[model samples]
Target: MKPFTDGDFIKTVIIQAATRWFPGEDNRRDFMNIVQNTRLSPATITRKVNVMADHVHEQLNIDLKKCVRFSIHLDESTDKTDTAQLVVMIRFVLENGSVQEELLELIPLTRKTTGLDVYLSKKNSILAHEVPLEKLVAVTTDDAPSMTGKITGFSGQCLRDPDFPRFLSFHCIITPRSILWENFKYKNRV
Candidate 1:
């Protein structure tokens, strides 16, 4: 029997269901069992998903061209496969005063994830998307050593760049407000 690999609706449905429930498994049998036998081979589903991702990525690049200013939040963490992945998210203000936040990319660190590694990955992503560096206003990252180390960290490299905009680099504080208050009180004797 031939696969029902026609129409945009089927592709959309497959993409939605795959993203919703599959999470990790992209097995044809798993999808067929749960998604009512769409008869799509694993290869077809993978191709459709890749095309959709490319479309979204292109749309984001276009939207970025409309931004008056943008800030990026980056976090690096080890995935289930023990690979270091950098999650880059962008928050930008459009010319019409509307704000938007989006996941720019998830980059895998194939080698040592040093400050240079993180910085290069982010720089490549921004350059590939053709986002103007002058429009970048800030960056936020967790207080990891590779992120906060002024002399050797990602922010340091950006700061050293002459063409790069003078952007604020802030450490994102994720602790509870109550705990922070207690710490402040103890430190300041207030």
Candidate 2:
């Protein structure tokens, strides 16, 4: 709470507190404790944070439109409470020759995550972003059956769909080959 007079600094404080799960009362107290007589209630902070998020989302959409080509990476895993979460990331090269990689979405699957489920969710996200499937050059995923299984996996579904553009599919390996080779050598030594 060191004296912060800048408006952007104030906004950053609110955003950080909100993201860090600070209670409403704590945020209010912190503002009150500030040297300046700034007024920031819990509700106001929440509203401001929401506005900031909306602005950032709009900027991301604009950036997506400027992408020359892009690739996606999908990974599905269960949370601590057994809730399935599909994490989608995107790597895109802008027209300016700069590449940007970002988290596109984290969709929580209310039901069990099947290959079809993943495909539909990803499709919706792509449509929402207004990104053409043709611009997608590749997709990377963890070699899970739901992601790679023929006829039932996400890539399989994409292959069957005529609307989907031709794109390379890859499996991201979790373990390094060197470590695997070392383990193999140790096991064979006995």
Candidate 3:
């Protein structure tokens, strides 16, 4: 039997499954097992997935620019390699009443988290490539003092000036799990 190599079909199935199933970290290995059992080389499957992701990103970029109102969600996480990275995700409502979210960029934090200036500079540089700073409607982030300070400083310096455009910034409070559970229980009882 010849090796079954249909990149497009495999890619479509993988993408659909990933999007629909919402597979967690452990489920990913099971997903890979299924793919491997298909008689397709792992490399071929990997390449196909990369191609699909690239295509999705290209379409998303075009769609995002045409959107008038959108929201920016910024979060930071540690990758498997133990590198601290900032992930910028954009949420937009299309003209057809459909909501679309795309991962805009992942920026590695080179310096220590204490260095607000360095982090701000890197964030600005990364964001400038995706969308104009002036066009941002609102920014959502956690209640980190450094992050809040940077946003205030940046907005004041760049957007508040007479020559620049003004934008809105919203901070979302993130608390510990115990506090969150208590709040959730209180809200439920109310």
Candidate 4:
């Protein structure tokens, strides 16, 4: 048997990092060097980080299940790694009537990003989280043609779906409303 419990030692490292109690990587290496016996490999640390991230992801899905009506906010941007990525977030009314926004996932686009591709990626992520089509109250995306173009766009494709809520499939308003309102007021004043 090992002299020390690996699980406990690894958890201690996770806790320190979580609480921002981590001193420095060099400090940790120096300490481990001094200990010699309990020194964990770099690979082992990486594995533990992946394990914790998976646990957090599972918990987020569980939390998302509690909200009935949710609006998906989709944005496309390059990640730190310079890979094209899509970021998905959700805003929902909680049980207490407070709105909560949670970042759901990041999806890397391995190929060309078309309207169909964005729509499918969003659909897959939502389905994987077990958020039903009925509960998807809205989809908010940027004004980019791939997302909002009147034809062959993500919003247009959604509108074609019989299951899609006709009233909510259109993206959350981000523009034009103010312009229209101003025009109306100006005409009325004149």
Per-residue lDDT tens digits for candidate 3, residues 16-128, read: 67645755866776776666566556576667778998898778767876676676766655689877776677777767878777777777866654335434753574455
lDDT of 2 by residue, 1-190 (tens): 4332345566666656653555677776675456245545556566777899899889888999989999999988888999989889999999999999988899998875789999999999999988767888999987678898779899999888888888999988673555799889999995
For each candidate, the alpha-carbon lDDT, in order, equals 0.83, 0.82, 0.62, 0.73
Off by over 4 Å in 2: 1-35, 175-190
**Candidate 4 — worst ten consecutive residues by lDDT sum?**
13-22
Task: Give the range where candidate 1 is weakest over 10 consecutive residues by summed lDDT.
Answer: 1-10
TM-scores, each model vs. reference:
0.70, 0.73, 0.58, 0.64
Clash pairs of candidate 3? none
Q: Write the per-residue lDDT of candidate 1 for residues 115-162, one digit (tens) a residue.
A: 998999999999998887899999998767788778788898889978
Per-residue error at 35 for model 1, in Å? 13
List of clashing residue pairs for candidate 2: none
Model 1 gets an lDDT of: 0.83
Order the numbered candidates by lDDT, best leading.
1, 2, 4, 3
Model 1: CA > 4 A from native: 1-39, 175-190
Q: Candidate 3 versus the native: TM-score?
A: 0.58
